[model samples]
Target: MATSSDSMLAISVFPSLTGAESVSDEELAKQSVINYVEAVQTGNIYESVKWVVDTRFSSTDEQLEQYKESLSSNPFSDVSIKSIVPASNDTFTASVELTRKDDGETNKVSYQVIKRTIVGRY
Candidate 1:
């Protein structure tokens, strides 16, 4: 959920700090976050990469491989977006949850989450 204080700070911070006065679009941020959690739950590496930030976290091979492995092995049934709220004007946080449903022989997994996203594609 986007908090009032967080929104206030975002509206104030970026112009001076990042140069961009406005914060990322709420819908875009929210979608990015949604895609991220959904991809993770579904173990779709390609989908996961689409919204991933190009930063230090993507550089380490060890962590990357581990994440890949984990995603590959997960038996995801579905992913659901729950809620999104702003933490700051430019920054928002989301809540996510995952579940596994058993169908006699196997279990299907799913994800439920809330906030966060990227620059353009909302």
Candidate 2:
């Protein structure tokens, strides 16, 4: 006696019910880098922290403020991922290019992104 809504809920809860495959490690790492860079460029502290695991910041608030200050000081016109290479099983090195908003200068940077599983989620 289940309704269509009930069926939808079940499918949403169990993705395997729809035959959807899990994301690969490489794809996850690449997406992590993209999300982190996008969040930084947009000055979104919360979103930026989601993809980063750093111990340098004393606390979440401190990290947010630091990222905010950095973004305000050096705004970017564009940020793009040039390449992503696997550095280890769960780590990837991404090459990125950024264009400054004020001077239109481009700079290349490398980011080491590590995929972690926390509470049964990637």
> Which one is best on lDDT?
2
Q: After superposition, which runs of candidate 1 have C-alpha atoms over 4 Å from their true positions?
A: 1-24, 53-60, 101-122
Stretches of candidate 2 above 4 Å error? 1-20
Cand. 2 Cα-lDDT: 0.64
**Top candidate by TM-score:** 2
What digit string (tens of lDDT, one per residue) describes model 2 on residues 1-122? 11111000000112233243485666666767777777777778787777676566778798788778878888888888888788777667777788889888887777776655554335
Please give the range of 10 consecutive residues that has the lowest summed lDDT in model 2: 2-11
- Report the Cα lDDT for residue 110, model 1: 23
lDDT of 1 at 9: 12
Candidate 1 per-residue C-alpha lDDT over 74-104 given as tens digits, one digit per residue, 9 for 90 to 100: 4446545555666555455554444443432
TM-score of 1: 0.50
Query: lDDT, candidate 2, residue 11?
Result: 5
The whole-model lDDT of each prediction reads 0.46, 0.64
